[model samples]
Structures are given as structure tokens and as C-alpha cells.
Target: MTKVAVISANGRVGSLVVKELVERGYDVTGFGRKAQNTTVAQTYIQKDLFELTKADLAEFEVVVDAFGTFAPETLHLHVEVIKHLTALLAGTKTRLLIVGGAGSLYDDPEHKTQLVDTPDFPAEFYALAKAQTDALTELRKHDDVDWTFISPAADFQVDGKRTGKYILAGEELTLNDRGESIISYADYALAMADEIQNGDHIKERISVVGK
Candidate 1:
């Protein structure tokens, strides 16, 4: 079985990723700052995410970074954590798969404007969005690390159900036939699991939306 570690495994998206990976027969482990009442992973590790070193993660074949933050003060941790992971996994065989944000995706066909720069972008999430954008920028600088950053659609619905269908795209934002950029956390998790099994987008950034 493929060994995988999911950081921040107690979070909404993280938990579902854990569930999906486990159901797919992967040897999964959940890492968090604290233990939760329930988790789908066969093993759980309680430790600060930053404190995790190469030695701690050397056993896993893949690491899924599902860490997220909305607080203005801590938003920069998004980039810092990605840097930390890449630095640790550099020259190693393990793959790092990041659960990224759509804010950095180009909103126009010309590839000129990002969704975060649009006038209709939510003011409340600007800081978080920018932080995630910076994280992607930082991840791009690492050439030795095997990494894949997967961004969700503009509408990342936490309460949305699994449709078992989605469309993947490149840097530009993608829309369904109905002209909407939306994806449920469940479907996003499904896509993540597929990527983990297939390893098709190594060292690339991709986006996904519901079909």
C-alpha cells in the first residue's frame, strides 16, 4: 500500500481527503496539532506542522498539505509552510501535494488578471487569498522538490455534496457548461485522490471545477 500523510487532517477538506484516501486503500496517517474525536486514517500524529522535519516524514510516499488559515495575522504562514515542506522534501522521493486556492488563477483568457484582483473579489478574504497566491509563487521556485499544487474553483463549497464529477484545467480559471466556477469539497477531495494515484501533474499547478 502507498503510505501517505495528510497535514491538518482535522480540517474540513483535510478530513475528507483522509476519508477518501483511506477508502481507496492507501496507508494513510493524519497529522494535526491535536487529536480529534474521530479520524479515518489508520494512524494519527499530534505535532505542530512547522515542527515536522524530514525525519518525521521520510517514511511516507506522499504528503498532502491541507493547511489553511483565514486570520490576517497568520495568513503568511501559508507560504512559510509550503517553503518548509519543499525544503524538507528536496532531493527526496516523497511527493508534496498542496491544496491551493483559486485566487492566483487567471480570471481572463489573456492571462492578465487574477481572480483575487477582480473588483468583485471578496474584501474579507483578500488577505487570505493573497497569502495563498504568495504560497503558490514560493512553491514555483523549488525545482528539486516534486510538488503539485491543486487549486479549487472560485466557489469552494464546504457544504456541497460529492457529485463524483469534475473538470480539470490549467492556470486559467475554468467554468462548467453552465458557466459557473464551483466545486464541492467532496469532489475536490475525489480529484486529489485521483491525482495521488495517477501522479499525472507532478511539478504543476492545476484547477478543478464541478461538471
Candidate 2:
């Protein structure tokens, strides 16, 4: 069985990822800031992510960081948490997958990625999202962990059931005729899990959406 460890078990996306993995028969372990909904997991470690030490990361093959939300105020903590987690997972074969945002991707041929250089986006959110993208860049210094930064569709959020369908894109962006990119939350979880099992887009940044 693939020994998988997921941080942020309490978060909406994290819980769904863990639940899906468990149902798929992987050895699922969850590290969460809360105490609820973890009984379904193989093992639960109740600890805040920043409080997690290098010793705590031992023996897990896959570590997915799904810890933050779209809320603007939590951006610094999100970036710092990823920095610390990558540092802790350094010097090992353990894989690191940081949950990224669509703000860093190209939404139109004539425009830059939505969040990086856009003036209309919220200032605090823009700064922090930019920082998160930068954190992924700085992580290349660690070379030990196999890292992947996954940016979801602007509206491809979690909070629903699995749809088992999504489209994987190779840049150029995927959008509907109406000029929008969207994927259900469950499909996003499926993509994250599928990447773990398939290893299709390792050491790269990719985006996903539903058909």
C-alpha cells in the first residue's frame, strides 16, 4: 500500500482528499489542526502545521499541503507554513505537493496570470498569493523532496461530492466558451490523488478543471 500522509486534515479540501484516499485503500494518515472527522483515517495526528517538526514527517511517502483558503488574511501564514514544511521534508525522497491558486496562471492571451500583475485583485490577497507562488520557486533550493505546485481553477473549489471527471491542461489555459475555468471540489481531490498514484506531472506546475 502507498503510505500517504496528508496535512491539514481539518480543512475542507484536506478532509476530502484523505477520505478519498482511504476509500481507495491507501494507508492514509492525517495531520490536522482540529480533532474532528479524522476517525475515518488510518491514523490522526492532531497538531497545527507550523508546530510539525521534521521528526513528525518521518516515513510518509506523499505529503500534501492543503492547509489554507481563499481568505486574504491567512496568506503569510500559508507561505511560511509551506516554507517550514518543505524545509522539514528536505533531504528525503518524500514528495511535497503544495496547493496553489489560479491567480498565478494565464487567464487570457492578452493578459497575465490573474493574481500576479493584476491591479484589480485585492491588495492583501494579491500580495500573499504572489508570495505563495514565490515560495514554490524558492523551494527549488531543497532538491531533496519531489515537489509539485498545483494551481486549481479559479472556481474549482472543494465543498462538494466527487464528480470523477476533469481535464488536465498543459499551459495555454482551459476555459469554457464563456471564458471561464471551473472544476468541482471533488474532481480537484481526484486529480490530486490521481497525481499521487500516476506521477504524471512531477516537479512541475499544472492546473485542472472539469469538462
Candidate 3:
């Protein structure tokens, strides 16, 4: 069985991801924002990430940083947390899977990545998402054991078939005829857990879209 840790595993999307991982028989740990009623994971931590020690990263084989949503305040926290995590997991042979913002997906064929090129995506949020995207991109250059930064679709709408069926591709956005990119949270979690079970698409920053 694969042993995995999901940081920020108690939120809406994170919680679902944790459940899916646990159901897959992975030794899963769910990091919660604060101590709460718990039973979803093999082990549960109440403290936020600021309290995470290298010892925490040492506990699992793969760590998925999923502790955030689309909050602008989280951009700095995302970079700060990832830098801290990369350092903590360094030289340990432990894998890292980063979940990133979709703003980086471009809607227009002629534009810069939709998030980076758009003048008006979300004024308060774009910069931070862009920063996180850059952080994930830079991580790929490291000669590490295993690292993946998986970006979701431009339309990562919460409601959709949870079927794990989806498309995985490189730097370009996978768009349908309607011109919207979409992937369910279920599929996202499935892909993450599948990677933990048996690694694939390694050391790459890619995007996922449902058919």
C-alpha cells in the first residue's frame, strides 16, 4: 500500500481528496486548519501548516500540498509553504505533488497563458496565482527524485461527473468545442492518488481536462 500525506486535507476539495486516498488503502494523513472532530484519515493533525516540522514530511512517502483555495491572501502562503516543504522533503527521496491554480491556463490561442496575460482575470488574485504557477514551473528543473505540479482546467467547475476519466497534457490548455476547459475535483484527486500508488508523468507540470 502507498503511504501518503495530504497537507490541508480537511477543506472541501482537500477533504474529498483525503477520502479518495483513504479509500484506496493509502496510509493517509489529513492536515486540518485546527483541531476538529475527525475520523476521515488514518491520522489527523489539528494545527495549520505554520506548525509543520520537517518531521511531518518525514512521515510519509508522498506529500500533496492541497491546503488552499482561490484566496489572494494565500499566494504568498503558497510560495512560502512550498519553499518550506521542498526544503523539508529535500534529500529524503519523498515525492511532492503540488496542486496549483488554473488561472495559468490560457483561454485565447493568441494570448499569454490566460492567467498571466489577462489584464482582468481577478485583480486581487492573479498575481499570487501567477507566482504559484512560476514556483511550480521552477520546481521541475530540480534533479529531484519525484515532483509534479498538476494544474487544473480553466473551468475546474466543482460540479461534474467524478469519473476519473480525463485528459493529461503538457503546457497547452485542452479545450472542448465550446471553448471551456473543465475537470471535476474528483478526477483531480483520483489523479493525485493514482500517482501516489504508482508514479507516472513525473517531474512535469501538466494540466488535466475531462472529456
Candidate 4:
């Protein structure tokens, strides 16, 4: 069985990812700052993500960085966490899979503008979006660590239904049949689990959208 660890496993997306991995029969462990009444992980560790040492994660084959923050002041945590994880896994066999944002994806086919640069991008999420974008940029600089960044669609629906279907794309934002970029958290978790099993897009950034 493949061993997988999910950071921030108590969060919305992280929890779903943990559940999906568990359902798929992976030897999964979840890391969080506190214990939770409900969790799908076979093993749960209570520790601050930054406090984790390389030895602590040495046994896992893959690590999913599902950490997220919306607070204006803490938005920078996105990049910090990415840097920390990449640094920890550098020169190691463990693969780092990051939960990224769509803002960094190109808005046009010519690759001229990113979604974050478009006029219609949400102003409220600009900080978080930019931080995630910067996190991707930071991840790209680490060549020693094997990493894959997966960005959800523009409309990351918190309550959207799980269709168990999604489309994967490169750096450009992908739209469904209705000409919109959107994905439910459940479907995104499905895609994440599939990617973990496939390991096809190593050292690359991929996007997912609802079908």
C-alpha cells in the first residue's frame, strides 16, 4: 500500500482529501494542530505543520499540502507552508502535492494574463489568490523536491455536489460545457485522489474543473 500524509487534514479540502484517500485504501495519516472527533485517517498526528521534521515525514511516500487561509494577514501562510514543505522534502523521495489556486492560471490562450490579472477576478480574494500564485512560483524554484501543484477551478464550490467527474488542464483555466470554470470540493478531492494514485503529472501544475 502507498503511504500518504495529508497536512491540515481537519480543513475543508484536506478532510475531503483524507476521506477519499482512505476510501481508496491508501495507508493514510492525517496531521493537524488538534484532535478531531471525526477523521478518516488511519493515523492522526497533532502537531503544528511547521514543527514537523523531515524524520517525521520520512516514512510517507507522498505528502499533500492542503493548508489554506483566508485571513488577510495570514494569507502569506500559503507561500510559507509551500516553502517549508518543499524544503523538507528536498533531495528526498517523498512527493509533495499542493492544493493550489486558479489565479495563477493563464486567462488567455496566448498566456498573456493570469486569472488574477483579469478585470473580473474577485477583488475580495485577490490577496489569497496572489499568495497562492506566489506559492506556485516559489515551488517552481525547488528542483530537488518532486512536486505537483493542482489548482481548482475559479468557482471552488464549498457545497457543490460531487459528480465524481472532472476535467484536467494545464496552466490555462478550463471551462466546462456551460463555459464556466467551476468545481465542487468533493469532485476536486476525487481528482486529487486519482492524481495521487496515477502520479502522472510530476513536477507540473495541473487544473481541474467539473464536467
Worst 10 contiguous positions by lDDT, candidate 1 = 33-42
Candidate 4 clash pair list: none
Stretches off by above 4 angstroms in model 3 are 37-39, 106-115, 118-125
lDDT of 2 by residue, 1-211 (tens): 9888888876777877887888889998898877775546789988888898877888888898987755666666766776798789878888888777776776577645545566666665566668666666676566677888777776755564567877787444577555678877778888888888887776777888776
- The 0-to-1 C-alpha lDDT of every candidate, in the order given, reads 0.94, 0.76, 0.74, 0.93
TM-score on alpha carbons, each prediction? 0.97, 0.85, 0.85, 0.98
Q: Rank order by TM-score, top first?
A: 4, 1, 2, 3
- How many clashes in candidate 1? 0
Number of residue pairs clashing in candidate 4, backbone atoms closer than 3 angstroms, sequence gap of 3 or more or interchain: 0
- Report the C-alpha lDDT of model 1 over 100-208, residue by residue, as the tens digit: 9999999888989999999999998888889999999999999899999999999999999999999989999999999999999999999999999999999999999
Distance from true location, Cα of 200 in model 4, Å:
0.5
Where does candidate 2 stray beyond 4 Å? 69-73, 107-115, 119-128, 176-178
Candidate 3 clashing pairs, residues 3+ apart or interchain: 106-114
lDDT of model 2, residue 58: 82
